[model samples]
Each structure stands twice: as structure tokens, then as C-alpha cells.
Target: MIIQGFYNIIDKTLALQFAAPDAMKDPFYVDAYNALNHFTGSQIVTEIPLKEMQSYINIATQYASQTYNLQWAFSVMMGMGAAMNFSMAYGRRNITKMKELSGNGFTSTILFSCITAFGVFCIVYPGWNAVFITSQMGSHYNVITEHLCWTYTIPLLAAAPLMFLSYFFMSMLRSEGKMLWVVLMIVSSLLVNCGAGIFFMHVCHLQLSGAMMGTVFAWLVQIIWGLIIVFGVKGSYLKFGWKDMLFLKWQNIVAFMKAGLPNFINNAALVITSFALTTLVVQLPNQSYNNGISILQELYSSITPWMTIVLSAGIGLTQGARSIIAYNYGAKKYNRIWQVLKRVSILIIIWFTLMLVVFICFGGLMMQAFAFPKEYVPQYRWWIVINFMTYPCCAFTYIALTLFQGINKSMLGTFTSSLRTFLVILPLIGIGYAVSMATGNPIYFFVFIGLNDLISSCIIVPILVHYWFKYRQKLVDLPDDFRSTSINEETFKDSLEHLSKTEVTAAKEQTTPPTKKQS
Candidate 1:
């Protein structure tokens, strides 16, 4: 996850470098381009002017990226259901149930991917066009609309299904304990994305279209690799065949929907909140200050993913542990869940604390590496400090939410995740925007952004503590047989074999014709 995070940062930096103004064509941007080239040392000729590129990239990609993210989140929810169901079935030594769930997951991915692709097309193309036209957003808005319609629409829609499938496959693979393979798949795809993007933009001079093309190509690679592993790999426990694809159970689909609800809410809320923030930033009274604030917000947004690498680590730990927790819970081994939670908590705290220190010490250097204006580095450094002040709080929230998810407590997980975005951050952003306007000071806006997680933590941590106690007591109250610490491998294998025979018998019965009625 850490390596993926660093790659993400590098990818973003490269995208900017490739979009930079051409020094020869625009002598005015020569100095700025030189500065950027000093950092990136790139020889690629870019046509987009620096003044226009930042806002263009930020706004144009915002809807496409977030829309895809929302879709990915939904697919993740489906994937989580598949993973948890498969893990639990494995715990019960029920081979039939495991195969059924895996099949249903694959079927769900196909249906959902098609729907999401269509939805994305509608939303980004016609839906946004209608919005721009009706709002009377003027000539600049028209340019943005044109860019979205012509440049981004096709590639984004094309990639949606491939990306969704790859993500679902990764989730299933993770459940099967193929974490190493999953990591390799992600790294390979990311490398392909960057390399392809560089080739298209530099060698072909296709610019934004080239970048989107790269994304499409990368997802294609990922889905193909995922297919080979899931279907062709020798040791994989979970495999989906054509028969599995043909059997779609409504109950299983509903279960996946229920399982994924919390994560979907979390992702959707984030997209909405981001849209809200962008709206607020663009509406500031002073155009100069507004532009500055926009740049700041963009920089902050770019830095946020890297800063949250620690949070990603926490999430990764939770993901890794979730299968164990789900499996143990299914197997009636309550004690093991607590053990996993304890170790994950300790590691998360240590990781977050260490990263916080690093970010505080070296944030300015990072800012410089991104080619942020030297004069603004001091201000940006302060933003980094303030923004990350609540890392520990965020870490705790993740632990709490993941625990809820692991145990299949979607409501509790949804509530916990929603509190930070809707109950805390959104309100703070609104109030901060109002205050900034009233006081003629933009600092208030950022201050509230920085403080949101800390404030939300006050509510979240207590809930987490309360649930921790409640669940722990519940675990303690389980029967002795249900609380066993060890599994009997022989008994487990016997049960699996028995279940497999039962499934075959059931299948034969379903396929056989009924006897003729007696005269």
C-alpha cells in the first residue's frame, strides 16, 4: 500500500509535467517551465499553458475521477461481500457455499459494470452538459464542457467495466490469501499506466486524450491478468467457471448490496463533499484570492493522497485482518478476533505517529519537489502541519469502521464513517466558508478544514470505545464450544468433503426429471 501510494504521487507529478506549457512556444512561461523541468528533468513538449492547465486538469478530471471512484466503491462493496462470504464459508468448511458466493460475485461484477459505464456516460456527457447550459456559466464553462465531452467521455466510459472487474478480482484474490499476487498485479498495472501515458503524451503528443487512453489500456491489462489468476492459477481456492457465471441468485446480489452499503456511502459522501468544496472555493469574492485559494486547494488535494498513505496502511491492515476476523467469527472462534484487533491497533498507531513526524519535518521539501512556488512554500508547509494534526484521530476512526465491517455490522460502520464526512467536515466547511466571507480572511476556511477530523474524533472515539466494550462482552458471553481457540484440520476436511457430496447430490436432483404420475 505504501509503495502504491508513492507511485500515485509520482504519477500525479508526471501528469503535471506532461501537461506543462511549451517553453519554446510561450517564452513567458519559459522560466516557470525551466523550474518545473529542473524538478522533473523532462524534455516532453506540452501545449497547455501553465495558467490554464491547473484549473483545467483539476476541474475536468474531478467529475470523471470521482464518478469512477463512486463506481469502484460500489464494486468494492460487492467484492467485500464476496470475500467475507467466501471466508466464512471456508471457516464452516462448506465448499458449496463458497463456490456459489464466488460465482454470484462474478455475475454481480458484470451486471454492475455495465450499469456503471452507462451511468458514467450519462452523468459526464449529457448530464453535465445540461447543467452547464442551464446555469449560464459563460464561455469558459463551455470550454470545460467541450473538453469533457470530446476528450474524456469515450476513454472513461470504455475503462469503467475493465476497472471494475479488476477491482472485484483483486478483492476475491485477497480473500484467497493471494495478497502477494494481488500486490504484483496492482504494481504491474500502475507501471503500465505510467509508461503508456508517457509514451502517448510524449511520443504521440496526444496530451489529455493520451493520458485517458493510457488509463484504459492499463485497466485492460489488469482485467486480463486477474482473469488468468482467477481461472488458470493452479493453487487458487476460489475459481469461477461459465456455470458460475450463468447462475445469478437475487439473494446473493442483495446480500452483496447490503454488505457494501457502508463503503458506498463513505465513497459517495466523499465525492459530494469534494464537489461542495470545489464549489465553495470557486465562489470567493476576490478573484485573485480565489485563484490563490484554488491553487492551494488543488495542492492540498494532491498532497492529501500521499499524506494518507499511513491511513492507507491502516486500511490495508484492516483489509488483511478482516478475512481472518470474518472467518473466525464464522468458525465460532471469538478469541482470535480480539488478538488480531489488538496487534493491528498497535501497528497503526506506530505507523501514523512516525509518518506524522516525517511529514512535519520534510513537508517543505516535498512542496519544493512538486515545484510549488518558492514564495508559497512557507504557507504550504503550515497547511501540511495543520492538515495532518488529526492523523491519530483519523487512524482510530479507520480501526473502528473496519472492525464494524469485518464483523458484518454495516449499519454501525456506515454511521461511524458518515459522521466524519457529513456530520463534521461538511458542516465545518460551510461555517468556515461563511466566516471567511464575513471576516475577509481565508485562513478561517483552512483552519476549519484542519480541525474537522479532531472534532469528529471526539464523537467517533467514544462510540468506538463503547462498541469495543460491547462486542468484547458479547464475545465473552459465547459458549465454550463457540469460543474455541483451535481448529481441527481433520474434522474440517471431513466436513468439506461431506458438504461437497451434498452439493453434488442437490445438483443431480435439480437436473433430474420428475417421475410420471401413476394411473
Candidate 2:
């Protein structure tokens, strides 16, 4: 996950580089200019002013990044189906069910990706002007639309299906306890993406379109690599075949959707919140803030992907722990679940603490690396400091969400996931927008956004505590025969093996019948 995050950072930096004065030399820009001229049937000037061209590229890149994020959120949503279902099936030792689930999950994801890609394509191509005309960047609408249509939207959407498949394969691999394989897939893809990106953007001068093409190629590589590991590799615990793919069932599809809905909502909420905040930022009434819109947007675009990198650590930990917790929960090893939770909590705390320290100490340098003016570094540093003030609360939310996912409490997970975004930060955004309007100062908006986690924690922490105690007591009260006394790794493995063997023997006996009854 961290490797993937660094890929995003590098990808964004590369895209931003084309916003320079010399960007007109890029083939992508020239092609877009020609295409727009042909479509509009007017000889638009080739020599657009350098600063104006830079602004167009900068804004286009920011919006393009947002579109990519939205696509990724949907991919994560679809991938969760395989992750949860396959892990649960593994816990129950139902190898057949796991294969069926994986096949059904992949099919459903592909169908959904096709629909989503088409929908987005319609919006970007024919509907771009109508959709964004009312946006806050009133005068720049035409430039934004043209850049997005030619460079980012068309190229990226073309590979949406492959991207979704990549994520689906990743989820299935993760559920099968193939973290090493997953890491390899991600690393290989990132290296190819970076290498391809440089070749396209610098050697071929494809600009942003080249970067999008590189992304598509990366997804394809990841999908092929994952397929090889799953099917070609020997000694894999799960078996998947063509029969599994052909035998689709409505029950299986519904189950996958049910299991994955919470994750979908969780990620979708982030994309929506980001969009809302960006819109609000553009609409701020302060003249000073309005004058600095370019800087503000650029800063936001730079900071968010890196912040996602920080948060992805916690998310990655939760994902790893959730698989173990889900398996144990299916095996009825309640004591082991608590033990895993405790260890995860400790690790999350350590990780977030180190991150907080890093953000505080080097926030200015981080902004400087993005080429921000020295005079503005102090303000950017404050943004990081205030935004991350409640960073510790994220640990609790992640643990709670993980616990909910592991135990199959999708509604609880959905609610908890939405709490920070919909219930807390969104309302705060509205209030902050109003406050900024009244005071003619946009700092209030940042402060309100920073308060999101802290305020949500007031609700999330209690719910998490209550459930922790409830589950702990439930474990203590379980019957002796059904409960395991020890929480060691060996005991857990032995219990699972014993149960699996017993189940196999029972199945054989049922199928064999009683031949001796004839005597």
C-alpha cells in the first residue's frame, strides 16, 4: 500500500511537471489544440500565453486526480466483495465456496466497472459543459473541460475495466493469505508505471495523456501478474477454474454485494467529501483567498495524496488484521480476536505517533519540495499541523471499522465509516463555509475541517468501547466445549485442522450410505 501511495506521489509530480511554460512542445497539448480546433471549426491560436497555459494544466491536473480518486474508490468498493467472502470461506474451510465466491466477485466487478466507465464517459464527453458550467471557477470552465476531455478523462476511462480487474485480483489474493504475492504485484506495477510514464511523457512528449496510458498499462500488468499467481502457481490453498466462472448464482452475487456495501460507502464518502470541499474552497468570498486560488488548489492537490499515504498505513494494517480476525471469528476463536485487536491497536498507535511527529517537524520542507514559494511555506505548515491535530483518533476509527468488518456487521461498519465524513466533516464544511463568508477569512474553513476527527471521536470512541466490552463478555460466557481456553497460534491452527478433518469425514459418511444394513 505504501508503495502504491508513493506511485501516486510520483505520478502526480510527473503530471504537474507538464504545467510549465514549455508544455506546448508536448504532443498531447498539440493534439488537443488541433482536436479542439477541428471540433469547434475555428482556428484557435497555437501560441497560448505561457502563464495561462500553466494555469490550465494545473487546474486540469487537479481535476484529473480527483477523477482518478473517484474511480479508485469504486474499485475498492467492488474488490471488497472478494476479500470478505473469500476470507470467511477460508475460515470455514469451505474451499469450494471460496472458488465460487472469487469467480462471482470477479464477474460482478467487471459488469459494474463497464457500467461505471460508460456513465463517466457520457458525463465527460457530451455532458462536461453542462455539468461544470455552474462550478465556482466560472471563467475557466471552457479550459477545464477541454483539458479533461482530451487528456485525462478519455485516456483514463478507457482503462477503467482493467483497473477494476486489477483491484479484484488483489482482493482475492489478499484473502488467500498471499500478502507477499500482493506486494510483488504492486511493486512490479508501480515500477512499470513509472518507467512507462517517463518514456511517454519525456521521450514521446505525450504529456498527461501519456501518464494516463502508463496507468492503463500498469493495471493490465497487475491483472496478468495476479492471474498467474492464482492459477499457475503450485501449492495454492484455493483452487479456481473455468467452471467456477461459468456457474454464476444470484445468491452469490447478492452475498458479495451485501458484504462489500460498507466498504463501497466508506470510500465513496471520501471522494464526495473531497469534491464538496474543493467546491467550497473555490467559492470562498474573501478576495485575498480568491486571488490565491491557484496556490490553494495546488497545495490541496499536493498535500492530499501524501496524506492518503499516511492514512494508508493505518488502513493497510487494518486490512491485514481484518483477514486474520475474520478467519478467527468464523472459527469461533473469540479470545484470539481480542488478542489480535490489542496488538493491532498498539501498532496503529506507534505508526500514527511517528507520522504526527514527522508532519510537525518537516511539514514546511515537504511543501517546499512541491515548489511552493518560501513565503507561503509557513501557511502550508500550519495547514498540515492543524489538519493532523486529531490524527490519533483515526486509530480508534480504523480498529472499530476493522472489527465490524471482521464480524460481518456491515451496517455497523457502514455507519461508523460514514460518521466522520457525512455526519461530522460535511456539516462542519457547511458551517465553515458560512463562517468564512461572514468573516472574509478562509482560515476558519481549515480549522473546521481539522475538527472533524476529534468531533467524530466523541461518538466513535464510545461505540467502540461499548462493543469491545460486549464482545469480551460474550467470549467469557461461551460454553466450555465450544470455547478454546488458549489463544496461541498453534492451538488456533490445530483447532481449525481438527474441525476441517471432522467435517470431511462427516461428508464422506453421508455419501457412502450404510451398505452393512443389507445383512
Candidate 3:
């Protein structure tokens, strides 16, 4: 659904007739042509339409807009996919038990994810476009066209890299389990997020752009932190062995790719859908209409930081719970797992409900902070309200999916993830565009955003209920002996060392084959 939403942004650009480059903006048309052809001819226009000029313009415009967004979205999707693959790879079974780990790796992952989400949220909400337009240097200040180009560029620039780094850091921490190093990395990264924001806003006097700058800086901090921990620190588990240092483990890489491939494909598909939705919306008759939609979307984007904080913390804690559940399940301590799940589920439910209430109650005040154009306030008001309304359903979906992850039933988890966007979101978005066009009802547009989630949950909830019952028995089936003991730090170290030695000795003994020569 997120991807679908993104595509809809592109569609809106197309509908607004903003997708095609307005050659009139170019100081030197010839120069513009040459530069475009040289750098991005694949994306730039080549031939003029031969027939039905208006209709052709419309069709071509949508196509170009969709294509442009699709390309960028694909790149971002690939980066995210890479992160997922790397993370799953690093956490493969028997390398290091998630139940027994120390240091900053996981913390760094959480921080990076939260920071990235926060940065993006800051950029999206409180009106970056306004600052963008007003903050332009000298000559471009009065030019709407120039302002449009710059305003549009900021989102793609600010968002894409932050997303990449978030995934990268998280993946690395999960894979390397370099705890202490990751902690330092996260601290530096946080400083980067907080520091950059403060610096840009205060010293540079660049209000929103500062947020973007801070995000980039945070990424740099994380990378450096990771490097320092791996190379400079002694006795760190993250340190590369001689073999790992000298050679890439292609097999391991492939394993991760295989495991995470589904997520990658799904993300890619969703991004494509987002581009499509954007294109469709853009094809509407007026630029103001597209801008209006953009405002609402921006509002949606703004909520991401808080959402990220919630999600990162939620996922991290759930991961810990999941590890416990898996262990207890394996040991056949069925009752304890149930107790744990019950407690965790109740906490999640209560917390999720509280967030929904807070958002709904304070949504107006929250929307006020953005200080959008007065003219658009009426429409924006409903957008915010509807989003708040959908919170419960969305939360339920997320909770259910997370529960699936805990049970090691990742297939269902994947399905839940896919269904949110592909099954529920895309179709609703299409219907919204159709209804708005046919009835000319602007209010109907925002309705689908909430409606889709509500309907999707309606479909998923029953399945989740059935599975919860069927697997409820599996959660607490651990043996009585396993229940009496807690997993400890030394357990993994001793087991790993013992296993490694045993394998090595067995190999040596096999090679020695006593008295084979006599035979």
C-alpha cells in the first residue's frame, strides 16, 4: 500500500501536466536538450506526438511521469531489498543466537531506523515545499517554474538515501552482531540526526532542508561507526576473520538473497504501483488538484517519524519475544510461550489503542503545526481526520503480522505484508481515481486511503484468528526442564567452540585413515 501511495504521487504529477519538461523554462533550449540527452536521454522526451495532440500529450505525459517515478522507485526498492537480504544473511541459524547477544548492533539498527523515519517525517510534514520555495537564492525566487523543479527534487533527494542507509545499518547490525561497535555507531548517528537538524536550523537558517542534511549526516555516522567498531576495536565479534577479510562469501550472500528475494520483489512491485497511482492522479485537469493531493500525502509522510519510532521499538521487542517463543516452542514448553504471547499481545493491543486515541484526539492540533495554505485547509482537515480513523485497522494489521513473525510462520507474514498493498491498496486507489473522475467529488479521494486499510483488515483478521487458534498450542509446548532454565551468555560461546573443535578433529581423523596403506 505504501508503494501504491507512492505511485499515486507520480500519477498526480502526470495528471497535472507536470510530468513533461516545459521547454520554456530552459534559458537555452538547445543546451537543455543536449544536457538532457547526454545525462538521461532514456527518460527525456525524444519525438513530438504526431496525432491527437491534446490526447497524445495527456497519454505521453502520464507515461513519462510514471516511468520517471518507476525508475527511481525501483532503485530505492533494490537498496531496501539489499538491506533485508544482508540482515537475514547475517542472522542465519547457529552463527550467534539472537537470544544471547551484547553490544550496540541491534541498538544501532533501531536508532538508524528511527532516525531515518524521523528525518523523512520532518522533511515531509510542517511544509518543506513552503520553505523550499521561499528559501531560494537570488534570481529564482520569483519564478514558479524554478520553484516547482526545486520543490519536487527535494523529496526524491532527501528520502531515497535516508531509506538506503536505514536498511544498510540495520542489515549490518543483524548480520555482524557487532554490539559495542553498533552502539557507538548509533550514538554518532543520533548526534548526526540531532546535530544536523540543530545546525541547519540554527546556524545555516535552513529550516526543513536541515532535516534532510541531518539525515545524510546520520548515515555517514553509522557507516563510520561500523568501520571503527570492526577495524579499531579489539575482541569484537564484528571483526572480520582472515578468510572473511580476504574473500567474499558468495554462498552466504546468495543464501541471504534467496531468503529475502520475496520481500525485494514485493517492494519493487509496490513501488511500481505507487508510481502508477501518482501518474493517474496527475492526469487530473488541474495542477492545484495535484498540489492538494500532494499536501495530504505530505501530511501522511510527516507521521512516519513517530510511526517509525513505534515500529522500530515494536519490531525490536517483538524480535526478542520471537526468539523466546522459538526457543520455548522447540523445547516443548507450550504453556510458557502462551503466557508470554498473551502478555505481549495484551501490551501491544493496549499501546496500539492508546496511540490511535492520541492521534485521533490531537490530530487537528498536529495538522495545525504544518501551517498549510489557508485555501487547502478544508480538504487537508478531512485527510488528517480520515488517516486517524484508519489507525486502529492499520495497527491491527501490523500487530497480526508481527505475531506471525514471532511464531516463525513467515509465509503468512509475507502474505499479510503483500496483501496490505497489492490486494487492498491498489484496487482502492484505482476505484478512488475512477470515482473522483466520474462524480467530480474531491472529498471521495481521501476516503479510499482509510477504506482500503479497513477492508484489508476485514479480510486478514479471520485468517489471523484461525491461525492463532491452530498455533496457540505450539507457542507454549516446551519441555518442563527447558522451562526451568534461562538461556545464558556462555552457552552459545561454549557450544560454538566445542562444535568447531569436534568438526576439525573429525576431519583430521578421517584424513589419517590408519593402515590404509597396508591394505
Q: Per-model C-alpha lDDT, please?
A: 0.66, 0.72, 0.46
Best model number under lDDT: 2
Query: Across residues 1-519, which tens digit of lDDT does each residue of candidate 3 receive?
Result: 121122222222222332223322333432443353353645554432221122222222222332233333333333333333333323343233221222222333333344444444443332554332222212222232232333333543445544444445444453344445545665556656666655654566443334345555766666666556545866444444444433434443443343333344445455555544444544433235221134433343334334434444444444344445544544556676667767766666666567677766765555443323445555565565664466556555555554554444556766775665577778877887778778876445557756866787787789878876887656544334421133333785787899999999999988985897766
Candidate 1, residues 413-475: lDDT per residue as tens digits? 888888766778898889888998998876677788778778877887888778667777656
Model 1, position 14, has a per-residue lDDT of: 56
Between prediction 1 and prediction 3, which has the larger TM-score?
1
**Candidate order (lDDT):** 2, 1, 3
Please give the distance, in angstroms, between residue 12's alpha carbon in candidate 1 and its true position after superposition: 2.5
Off by over 4 Å in 3: 1-93, 96-166, 171-188, 197-211, 227-237, 249-251, 261-344, 406-410, 477-519
Q: Candidate 3, residue 128: CA error in Å?
A: 26
Model 1: weakest 10-residue lDDT segment is 132-141
